[model samples]
Target: MPDIEIRQLKKDDVAAFKAIRLEALEMEPAAYASSVEEWVSLSDDEWASRLHMPVFVAFKSGEPVGVMGLLRQKASKMKHRSTLIMVYLRDSARGQGLAESLIDAVARFAAESGVLQIELNVSSENGRAIRFYERNGFRAIGLIPAGMIQDGAEVDEVIMARRLT
Candidate 1:
């Protein structure tokens, strides 16, 4: 751990968020649902509006290297739950415990927002991510077959959840 700084991203940090997000999509095509093309096609305002959600970015030596976001359920009945999204770390930043740091930041934010549980969908082919989530106390609750299709290939998604309360 080299003094990694994890902070909640604000609207002013749109560019930083976009860069790291696009890098995530491009570097690991199968890891995320969003594509680099989709992100690049967004307008300035569209990009800014996305920062409205809780997005946390990891900074190593003043440069953003990783990101993780939380989307709290809007429905009143499901307010206690939130979906984790856009989790990624640059190849250079992996194995330095930066990913866990980002998750810890999100967990703190979610716990403060009255969220009882945090859930995420991981591609079945990404065993590394699945294991990482498991080490962080997330458990596989279910599986969705053909949850994502890319380049004419279907990838299953594993649903995992961790209770905060």
Candidate 2:
């Protein structure tokens, strides 16, 4: 694989972001809470607004191949925590260290921003993803029964967290 560059996505990246995001939703509908239909009709301004949070995209040869975002808690008492969300990598980008690198970038960013912990929720059936998060220092903290509904089926979600401080 060629060198992978990970960087913070800016407002100018709306087009690429929209393309990659839609692809993710299309390719793995069960993996995400949001549907392609929900985002496909969004205007440019609405898409750009989503990037107001810290979203990072991974690129190879200048083409986006992966994306992730860190959402900080807005409440005064919860500001020390952040949630890692919208994590997805192209099929071709898997099995490499790219995901780890993307996660490390988020952890570093969170620590720098005074966040003491980071959390994420993954489908319980996604063993691969659960293992990946565990390897990266996230521990299973709890489980939400029937946390999500996909294709008329109830799916359990495992909540994981890593202490940064």
Candidate 3:
């Protein structure tokens, strides 16, 4: 694979984002919040809202294959913390550290945005993702029992956090 480049998301790139997001939802249905088919139905405004969350996409030879976002909390008490969401990497982008680069960009963006902590919810069944978070200095903080409803099935979520100084 060629070198992957991680950059901020642009409004015009919503199509690419939708494509990879839908692929992630389809490929790992249990691990995502939305489905591929559902993403396709979302309006253009909904797709544009993604950029507000500090979105970033990874490109390999100009094709987007990885995406992640930092969503700031709305409540005042938790405003210091930003949620890390929508992290998805295509199969071709894996094993090349593209995901890690996306993550590194998230950390930078969070710091710049005045966020002190970055949190994410991961499925309990995805051990590889848990290990990846651990290797990147994230610690499991809590568990959300039956927090996710996927395909009429109840799935638990593991809360993990990484602090930014």
Candidate 4:
């Protein structure tokens, strides 16, 4: 594989971000809570607002390949925690250790930001992802039954977390 570059997304990256994000939602409908239909109609400003958080994008030789976001809790009491969301990689980029790099980048940022923990939700049916998270030190903290409705069916979601401090 070529050198993969991961960096914080800027406001001007709205178009690239939208393209990759839409592809993710469309290609892997079961892995995400939001559907393509829901995200497709979002205005430019709405998409740009997503970058206000600590969202990072991965590029393989100048082409966008993956994206992830870290959202810090705004409430004072929960400020030590952040949720990892919107994690996705293009089909061509999987199984190349890129995901681990992304997770490490986020964890490093979390530690620098004084966050004590990071949380994420993953579909129970995605065994590969569950194992990947576990390998990266994130353990299942809880399970939400019927947490997401996909194609008229209820799917369970596992809540996973890792302590950064």
Candidate 5:
């Protein structure tokens, strides 16, 4: 294991955030709903605004290696839940426990914010990710057929959730 530091990304860290995030979007197109083209087109202010959310970034040797974000449900009826988003780990950083560290960071933040459950949707084709989530206490509750389409190819999505309370 390397000297890994997991911390919340701040507005001032836009450059570092963009670098790692753009890499994720490009490297794993099937893993994320957002595309590199869409994220790359964002203006500086747009990127800065996104940092306001609780986005946890993993840093190794002062460089970002993984990221995970939390989005709390805003509707009055769904206030106790949060959706985990934008999870990614660089190839060099995988299998070193950095991904789990990122998840733990988001889980702690979500629980602290009064969130009782955290949910996520992972591409069913991504077996490694599915296993990782299962190991982290998330259980598959449902599946959406043809949930995502990458390059005109349909992919199923697995819905998983973990309780914080």
Candidate 6:
């Protein structure tokens, strides 16, 4: 493949981001943290807001092929924590270490952004993702049964975090 460039997500990237995210939710149903229907009904404004969030996308010639985000929580007690979410890559872009690169980018961003810990919930059945997170220095904190419901089924999720402080 050609060179891939990582950049901050932009408002104009809604369609591309939506397309890849939908493909992720549909193709790998058990590997994601979201549902296809949720993405299907989201309006352009919502997607624009998403693009404005602290998220990044990997581009190959201006086409978005991967995305990741760090959604900061606002609770005073949890001010040091942010939820690591929406990690996905287009099928053709998989296996090129994009996921690891994305994770590293997020880690550096979080550390620099003053977050003490960044956490994400991975589906229990997604062993590869779990291992990848662990390999990237995230440790499993606990298991939440029925933590997330997807497509009428309740699935367990593993909450993992990597400390920046």
Question: Model 2 RMSD to the real structure?
Answer: 1.0
Instruction: State in Å the error of residue 102, model 4.
Output: 0.9
Q: Alpha-carbon error at 35 in model 5, in Å?
A: 0.7
Clashing pairs in 2: none
Cα lDDT for residue 59, candidate 6? 80
lDDT, candidate 5, residue 51?
87
The 10-residue segment with the lowest total lDDT in model 5: 1-10
Cα lDDT of model 4 by residue, 1-165, tens digit: 477899888888999899989998988989987889999999999999989998888889888899889999999999999999989988799989888888889889889999999999999999998999999999999999999998899999999999986
**lDDT for residue 71 in candidate 2, whole number 0-100:** 92
Q: Is candidate 3 or candidate 4 better by TM-score?
A: 4
Compared with the true structure, what per-residue lDDT tens digits does model 2 show for residues 1-165? 577799889999998899888888888888898999999999999999999999988888888889899999999999999999988999898988998989998899889999999999999999999999999999999999998999899999999999997
Model 1 weakest 10-residue run by lDDT: 1-10
Q: After superposition, how far is residue 88 of candidate 5 from its true place, in Å?
A: 0.4
Off by over 4 Å in 2: none
Candidate 6 yields a Cα-based lDDT of 0.82
Whole-model lDDT for model 1 versus the true structure?
0.92
Candidate 3 runs further than 4 Å off: none
* Reference-based lDDT, residue 157, model 5: 98
Over the stretch 1-165, how does candidate 3's per-residue lDDT look in tens digits? 356688888888788787777777877888887667777788978998866667888988888888888889989898899988888888867887778888998899888878899999999989999999998879999999998997688889999999998
Local accuracy of candidate 5 as per-residue lDDT tens digits, 41-133: 898899999987888899999999889888889999999999999999999998788898889889988988999999999999999999999
What C-alpha lDDT, on a 0 to 100 scale, does residue 144 get in candidate 6?
97
Root-mean-square deviation (CA) per prediction: 1.0, 1.0, 1.6, 1.1, 1.0, 2.0
The 0-to-1 C-alpha lDDT of every candidate, in the order given, reads 0.92, 0.92, 0.85, 0.91, 0.92, 0.82
List model 1 lDDT by residue over 1-165, tens digit each.
666799998888888888888888899888888789989989878988999999999999888899999999999999999999999899899888889989998999999989999999999999999999999989999999999997889989999999997
